[model samples]
Target: MKKIILLCLTIVLYNCNGNAQKTAQKTEQKAYKVSKTDSEWKAQLSKMEYYVLRKAGTERPFSSPLNKNYKAGTYVCAACNTPLFKSEHKFDSGTGWPSFDREIKGHVAFGSDNKLGYSRDEEHCATCGGHLGHVFNDGPINTTGKRHCINGVALKFIPKE
Candidate 1:
């Protein structure tokens, strides 16, 4: 009986170590090395944008100037300048945040987010791993229930001329 218990403990520890290693590897692949200084980012972004994008802060819901921006444009990553969301995907989720139903292929990555102690999809810049926001399953039923709640500061809208 003691031998069996010892074997189980060993297996649990081994699995835990394996999981930790895998998590580390995944983080390494997703992390973006900062090449720009804080001053540089500040210069490139407005004070509010810098606060949300660079500092990983969230803006108050329904307060963003872009919440109602319904123009045709491409939404790009504020950090790495990668195009992530298309105008067609943008929708008003009525949650006071910029919502998208889809993203440009290969530009955004989704991961399980438990930031608020609940399971949700966390959206990030695929190339830069910058935190954009979380996704939920409470969006429009005509489309998928997926609501990609994005931080305005994490995006740059480029309107088509």
Candidate 2:
């Protein structure tokens, strides 16, 4: 009976090891790709935009001119000018930064952020490997606990007439 129990334990260990190996392989496959060269992106973006998006610098919270903007329009990528968020999706998170409940579908990508040891959602530009900001779960309950903590430098607002 001891030998049978030992065999069962070995089987479970082997299965767990295989699962770990597969997870590692999958992670390697999904590695973030730096699609644009640093110089290329710099040439396309302004100094402030290049710093915030490429260098992962944060803008002053609650200081963005768009934070109080309530007009209907679209916010586009400051670097690539890609449409990212609609004015309709914008909300006051009172967190000092312009917060959005949702993004323009397929414009941003989500990744696991473990920088500070705590796990949080990270947002990145789908076209460029630019760091937009982090997303939090403490947003309005009506819309999913999704807060896109975006940098003011990373976006340019186009007011709708």
Candidate 3:
């Protein structure tokens, strides 16, 4: 029994890496076409926008006026003005955030986020690496079946001309 207990303890200790985490935050980040200094981003974005786009924070549900906006326009990255979701893809998800069925292909990048314990698909502006939000499998069946639940502050509405 003593030997068995010692073996178990050794195995547990061996599995740990001196408090280092096994995953989540990566050592190096992918390069983006539009990069800016921390100060620049803070200066350009509003307080709430900075929180959502740069800090990966969520805004209060139903707080964003864009949530109920039904205008025909394009949604661009608030950080870099990169066109992301089109007006045609926008949908009222009843989720309080500006939801979209799809993004302009190749403009948005996908990453893994396990911050919520379970894994979630993370979205970012491919050009600026701004935190847009998460994408889920739940969406219109006739469409792409992707619900890109994005933060409104992370986006800017551009009316069609």
Candidate 4:
């Protein structure tokens, strides 16, 4: 009975490890519309941008100038220049990041992220699959009530001409 229980525990542990590895591999294997080699991405983006966009890393809060920007412009994907959020949709969430009440239609993609030990709706640039940030439900009630808390490094602001 002891041997049988040990074998069962070992099998469960192995399966769990395999699943974790598969998840990592799947992330690596997934391709986006604007695929680039690691070298290409590194060459095209700054070190901070590369970390946020390619490695799915988050930037320090209050570190982005766009957080306080209130200009009339469009926020676009830093990687592919895809328009994401318009100036009108931006709001002062006070989260120290650029928060948007909404995204441009068809410009962003959603996925489940469990990195924080809870389910979070992660947003990414649809064109380049760069990690933008996460969305939350606690937003202005007058609007969509969705806060797209994005990494400023993942976007480029194009002021209206």
Better of 1 and 4 by TM-score: 4
lDDT assessment of candidate 1: 0.81
Query: What are the candidates' C-alpha RMSDs?
Result: 4.3, 5.7, 2.4, 2.5
Between candidates 1 and 2, the TM-score winner: 2
Regions more than 4 Å wrong, model 3: 1-24
Tell me the spans in candidate 4 whose CA falls farther than 4 Å from its real position: 2-29
Candidate achieving the largest lDDT: 4
Q: Model 2, residue 56: displacement in angstroms?
A: 1.9
lDDT of 1 by residue, 22-97 (tens): 8996786444544566788889877777777666678899887778999998988877788998888889888888
Per-candidate total of colliding backbone pairs: 1, 1, 0, 0
TM-score of each prediction: 0.72, 0.74, 0.88, 0.88
What digit string (tens of lDDT, one per residue) describes model 3 on residues 1-161? 99999999998897775435544345557889999889999999999998988888999988888898889999999999999999999999999999999999999999888888999999999999999999999988899999999999899999998
Task: Return the TM-score for candidate 2, rounded to 2 decimals.
Answer: 0.74
TM-score of candidate 4 against the unseen true structure:
0.88
Which lDDT value does model 4 have at 34? 95
Residue lDDT tens for model 2, 119-160: 878887887657788888777788777888898778889889
Residue-level lDDT tens digits of model 4 in 1-161: 99999999999999999999999877875567899999999999999999999999999999999999999999999999999999999999999999999999999999888998999999999888999999999988999999999999999999999
